[model samples]
Target: MKNVGVDGSTTLKVYESRGGYVAARKALAMDTNAVVEEVKKANLRGRGGAGFPAGVKWGFLPKDRTTTLLCVNADESEPPTFCNRVLMEHDPHQLIEGTIIAAYATRSQVAYIYMRGEFHEQFHVLQKAIDEAYEAGYLGKKVLGTDYALECYIHRGAGAYVCGEETGLIESLEGKRGQPRIKPPFPAIEGLFRRPTVVNNVETLSCLPHIMERGADWFTGIGPPHSAGPKLFCVSGPVNKPGCYEAAMDITVRELIERDDMGGGMLSGRKVKAVFPGGLSMGVLTVDELDMKMDFEDPRNYSLLGLGTAAAVVVDDATDIRLVLRNVARFYGTESCGQCTQCREGTSWMQRIAQRIESGAGRMEDLDLLLETARNMGMMPGLSICGLSDGATYPIETIVKKFRPELEAAIRSQPAGQVEAVLQAAN
Candidate 1:
């Protein structure tokens, strides 16, 4: 069993011993355009909630454009998702090699690793690795004695979830408030100082080295068709063994939970209540659908759940759905940059309603009002700066739709003892 968090251990020597930099060497030997074509063939999608195809994004850079940039989104602020942290700390060079290959494919001259400010330890680890690469001649001008010239730098973000967004990150990097920019001139066309840029998540880039090292067919064949390659599943909450697990895409929630190799079921033999296959943004799945596989298409087709970043968060029978929704609502509300009227006001309104309901101060009609407000907030595309507006509204809509009985029960019972119990258990 090879350790998955190999990059986190600051064992760059060990990483090289495990065939780490082979992909960069191979990529340098091939034509840049061919590398992009190979990535396209692999069908590698973005792991940063968007699920956009990575190669297609790389191909979007204008051929005539100069001064292209590749920005790695390592700001994993999505609650309960820790896959990127493991990759950065365990296998820094894997990301470095992947970033170089991506830059080569896009003909970018420079790259930046925009990381979360709280990841101080991992940031230092990556910074050390970048220095090692530059010293070893893997980075900087004319790398590996080839005509290609590139450099990689690390930029720390000031702990804003909105900065996880591509355009918001660009603004934050420029020392401004983190607010997402409207698309039309998408990041691919104009990004990072108004030049052509391609923003990819850490996991999306980490897999690139292997994709180029082994071939697009080999990379695509690792996981299920369409949803190709190994995914790092971040399992947390009430599970016996809560941590990250790298496995094929076809593994179901039942297998992941019950199997000893993964989280090994709920702690203390508790009943599974609900599962968020992707993160807070994705719709929740009831216990009845526990057998649903954690793949791109399976959840989409069977459970109506979006596969954003392939992040799996499990909630047990002891957990209260209303309580969880309240916390989730507060996160969105607090993080809303207040750029758009709907998101600015809607997030605050949703949080207040959820809190009232959770605290037993809410009226029966408040449910309908919350749902209507959420629907109204979601009316426009690219509404509040980034998807913060959409992200906040999604869980509210999903919780109301999927757990109406629970909401109704909470409202009807209104017992002080039970409310206190739910509140205590939630914390």
Candidate 2:
């Protein structure tokens, strides 16, 4: 209840009443290195799906560095995930305070928040919060009478999911096509305008203020030892309460779905058929695995599904697996930036096959072809420019592997009624 984004509106008054800027005040009083040390002790990991440690990332920047940049990735284009908008809309100052602390720790003077173009309301709210902070002396030169000077800017992206990637974001910020740059000159070492930059997610940076205020031990005590701190799980589809719930990381999907405080089970008294634990990128889980723990490690341990974005999408018994695959394939095919041959051609191929199969034009051999294309497209370890290729392949691979019987059945059934059922269930 304390950290719920929907509880209080995201405004200067509401934020101040909830002790919003107190962390910024406390941070300004401490040595910058001490703040970095405290964050390191907290073992805070990136919430941007990569799970990189925030403090370690800060430490990677060169000492006595000037002109360093802190870029916040607010492009929450991952399909089933929408928690970042809540944070930006309901609690903008927390992000501001966290940004200032991170900038100070890295000795950066400028920060940019790269938000998704679709988030017009969130952008307006965050822009207003930034204006309020500058007027209130929380941002700009001589903040709270301290020598630290920080300036934050907001940049809206053009609805590209690839922009959620750090290098792609940097490229977009530079007014170029959002293609990912190669690593080894990692973003921490050489990033944004070729200067040492720290690109963090909106949720990742927002937690910094709380970590500083509550101390590392307090944060670590909230969740499981490995995945410390509270996580915001965005549940959608067929659930009685389809919204975001902020709880400890160790909470199980079964508990979340069944509890009145969370998802509260499937809607219309329908039984769950499948669940996508971490958005579509994490593949899918059949009904038997619904009890899997909603942690960073549990999915892999239980179902071999990687925890990609923490977006829980429930699919009830009335759902059709083939239609789900085709819809997801279409999304990836359309969203592919066409930067790489593997992604561009492979996504198109997968989409076509899924469509053909749905239209009853598919041969029994088409299923094998679909699996082959996905496998050869570098779904694992990623051969494309960004993670889009891998993300597309995940659902296809899982559907064919785990739900093969369903696909085969759809292929055998009469095209009119059965295919209609598949398409209808997709909606």
Candidate 3:
């Protein structure tokens, strides 16, 4: 991300002038296992929501697998997340070089960059870079004069948020409806036309070029031991400088929101009521808890889902918590693929409950109702096919749990009949 605007042009020539593709050349010279080992040693966790180790994911491929496919997830559908888009739009060749290296490491002859259909500008920029790579022989029949060959293509998605899921993206790329497939036969084992496929996020693949340049040890030394490397964070909502910034995980939630170089404090006298530490899906953090570190494991310590995309959305104190909950619930409800019974019903149920609460007719028991409904919908209960329901639940659950007093007060302020109905229901 730091290299985003370093060069004047997005073309391959300018990228090469800055020593781009050197990593690809270096990675191609190493044995496949050796390249994978270097990544493993770096402990490069995926910048995508899950925070899974990238090298470990690659190692999951079967040893005897003959035909492998690499899917680069450029579908940046997660709300408040645009770091991946910025990478592809400004420094496309960096992502291309990284993709070439990733294909080589996985021994894949074909790679598909599944981009969001809405990224019209980014599409042309990345495609231009691809054309440049082919012209320079960095990709295609023979990559950089090496025996290894790779064909990379940009396949735009129809803007379905579910396609951000690996199997859902595979389904969309396969010309089917973009719904998630059941696990156990994870993409690594049987994927994309039933061949072993490696599904990596755009930002995750973009890290490879850097790793290949600086050895794994150099990469690991930047951040914590378990999760090491520079991370691109997106800070949005009411902040002075609401944009993307790069740093190691050592930066805290407060620093991300208040640091001069980052969000630069809330916009002119607006106090933070709450902030979504790792995007809306990761659950809310109270202003008091802003000091918590924005790292993979630290978020769990603070009861968040995970580090997520590191895309923080700030909610000002003047905003109603009920409205925030309603907004988040509505998004997940509308986006649900309606496949799993739990997710289908759970999301709608929670959304309706949230809307009622926001509109001042909710029962006091609805708070618990929302939480109970969420509990049964996600992978945690082994009910849903993917994490969409899980994402829907976190914000609502956390909002209701952390801001109960405010919601209860709202319920109390209603008309006598409503208050009595709430008290009677509670009894």
TM-score of each: 0.93, 0.93, 0.96
**Least accurate 10 contiguous residues by lDDT in model 1:** 1-10
The best candidate by lDDT is 3
Model 2 lDDT tens row, 191-306? 99999999999888888889988899999888888788888888999999988888888887877776899999889999988888888877888878877887777888654446
* CA lDDT scores, all candidates in order: 0.83, 0.84, 0.89
Pick out the ten consecutive residues of candidate 2 with the lowest summed lDDT.
1-10
In terms of TM-score, the best-performing candidate is 3
Pairs of residues at least 3 apart in sequence or in different chains that clash in candidate 3 = none
Local error of candidate 2 at residue 30 (angstroms): 2.0
> Any idea what lDDT model 2 has?
0.84
Q: How far out, in Å, is residue 1 in model 3?
A: 5.3
